[model samples]
Target: MSDYDFELPDARIALRPAEPRDAARLLTSYADGRLEDRIVRDLPQILAPGDRLVVNDSRVIPARLVGERLRPAGTARVELTLLVEDEPLRWTAFAKPAKRIGEGDTLRFPVPGGVVEGRVEARTGPTVTVRFAADPLAAGAMPLPPYIAAKRAPDARDESDYQTVYADPPGSVAAPTAGLHFTDRLFSALAERGIGLSRVTLHVGAGTFLPVKTEHLNEHEMHAEWGTVSAATVAEIAATKAAGGRIVAVGTTSLRLLESAAGEGVLAPFTGDTRLFIRPGFRFHVADALLTNFHLPRSTLLMLVAAFAGLARMRAIYAHALRHDYRFYSYGDASLIFADPR
Candidate 1:
């Protein structure tokens, strides 16, 4: 995993996205190690007419909550970022000051009508399962990536800024950042050029931000996230392939879900939890091209991109991005990588 590491300047991290979204710079990398610089709005020029863009349309919910934990001694400030929904009202969350929280302890969050309470039901290391007294969506804050959150706090604007223009199925705690660069105008432009657009849903989990702790990549445990690919979309993918159209996944989530649904070398309708993890040397079954944002150093996301774009080439690409001052991480610029045919 250390082989994937690269030096990134702190100044390259983007605190906010490009104002028009589509104005974000795009870096294109090809199978033969060729590179081009473009902008997000130039997708129509970058992609062929018959190519299809498979995007994740999972909506981001306000999953971060600031509350006070009621303990025997007194009340302590606790911040919770909801992860997977284990039950109707129960969510697995990462609690700040996890050591201070205990099973059965109640947390109170002040909201519009009344205070929403959550009682801790169980613990697995840093994660705790909390059953909410009311719907968390009503008062939860937007769960921003910690890298961004550490620099500044989430605000009213993030409720809109953090989500993609096409997001509809409200479930994910995190935004599929690659889709963030798209705008209504860009969508119209792509459609006008005959670039087909398809949607999949992957309720991105907060666990996506967790760092890999194992020395060997294979030893890392993948967190399960729910996703769905409709029968109609599967047919579209097949039709695209039949016509020699490229399957361009908009983000890692879409790529993972598409690969997960591809059993026996073909895509089928699917709706379930997927714990798929892509690393270098993994054979890709669906995506021919990928549009993604710059990822963290030595992170699984980077590994996945390396797997798609090739390791040495990805290193060169990242070095070029850094040299050009392209933004890094969730609010960053974009990259278009064509998979190696080999």
Candidate 2:
């Protein structure tokens, strides 16, 4: 809400991923306010031995469902984006044509095996909670981000292209995109360079795309997301810090989870829901540097980067990115940002 805004050219949006995952462009913003252009494959040259790169392993689930709301009058087409699960069979979702739906109405979704259905239990605006008779995961399609979805329909290629190679825990509605640039070749390259890797989990929710509505950023209701930092991951972070190695978060999800686990002091093991809303003036306790993609304008993700690197510095970085016509959004280029000492 705080004037965190900008304009981006349409051509800057990347409709598809880079041919070779490692071939994507990378913008490096150093602590001294210097910017350098590099490709994703140059990580080995940018990072030194002992530097640990923390990544999110949460897999993107095909959570978008196309169904019909059946009633005595007629059937109405409905689209749902599953947001979060409160129970094994109950989930909160964003529904299109939500106004036409009422409580207790059945929604039928077709899938490969058979038809799956859910009953709406409650509704609050566009958000609805539904209890499914059968698992909806099997019937859903990859919930592509609005920006990408606006450009093209989700195809079979996206099933693999949108996910990271390390994705394991199946819960997120969207990909931890920074992880998408990685491949077996990139992993081997990082390993040969002595760069260590660690993982955490943050089931990214639908709220990631919700715009900041309040004029004051603090007044915005940050959506809570489930995440976990095991004792092992914390140990790895501590070892990296102790060894004078930089802890490089592979994406904002990893960085946010680490900071949420750290609280105000030292990094620690944690597992729970985190609604941590980072902005300017927020102090970071874990990540020494971050490897993330160019985010949407005025988005919380951009604000988080502004907080990690300085706001003025971030503006300059984005200006460069826009001027150079670097690809943007989920399938776009990435940036390696170092926190300002100040």
Candidate 3:
């Protein structure tokens, strides 16, 4: 939103995740927006041995379904991205042909693999509320982001690739992408080098890609995302702070969860929802380094990067990345960012 402009070739989009997690590429940009290219495998060499690496292990759920219009009969298939569950069978959804749908209707799926039935409960402008009677995933499909172009719907294969290796206690609709770059070897190397590790969970939501539409920036209301910080992770951060160890947030989600939990320069154990929006002039209470993917232009995630690393620097970095052909978005490559010094 800050007048940052750049062009990215569609050819640079990464269709699939990099193999051997740690084998993915990495971009390191300076506070001044200088660029450096390296392999993800070099993380151990890039970061200091004692720095704490905090990661979000929230796994993505199979939240997309293909259903059919009931009243119209033989109508085109409707694709629904289940947003948030309100009750046991009740959910808020982003339904396609959003034009043809209305309140108090039912949707049927001809999909052979997953759950096939649901009744529309309500309609609030863009969202179709549905109380699912079937386990859609069993009959439904996994929903990929709007960025990743695909021919067919989600299948059993997506059940695996759409998740991270450390994903446990599944709830997120999107993967904590930074974790995608870590395999056992990467962890082992970090451990062998005495690099510290910590865990935090932020159930990423569909709002992750929601663009910043407000100019004041402060007026942009961030959707609250549920997060949890275990005692162990809190202890790690506390000890790191006590020992003067810097906190290296594995992803923006983890960074947000940690900063949300930190109120008075000390991190407390937390388990709840947070809508802490980071923008220009907002002081970061915790986290020193961030490992994140290249985000979409004019997106909230991009604003977060701009907030963490100066806005001008981030724009320059994005421009540099675009020029250097760095992959962009969810399935793309990653960058290691340091918090900006104001």
Q: Which whole-number lDDT from 0 to 100 does residue 95 have in model 1? A: 87
User: How close to the true structure is residue 224 of candidate 2, measured as C-alpha lDDT?
Assistant: 88
Model 3 clashing residue pairs (backbone): 114-138, 114-139, 114-140, 115-138, 115-139
Please report, in order, the local distance difference test score of every candidate based on alpha carbons. Answer: 0.91, 0.91, 0.79
lDDT string, candidate 3, 255-314, tens digits: 889989986767889999999887666678778888999887777777778888887778
Quantify how close model 2 is to the true structure by its C-alpha RMSD in Å: 1.2
lDDT (10s digit) by residue, model 1, range 47-90: 99999999999999899988899987899998888887878999
Q: What's the true lDDT of residue 150 in model 2? A: 80
- Model 1 alpha-carbon drift over 4 Å, by segment: none
Report the poorest 10 consecutive residues by lDDT, candidate 1: 1-10
Q: List the candidates' TM-scores in order.
A: 0.98, 0.97, 0.93
Per-residue CA lDDT of model 2 for 198-254, tens digit only, reads 999999988887778777888888888999999998998888889999999999899
Deviating ranges (above 4 Å) for candidate 2: none
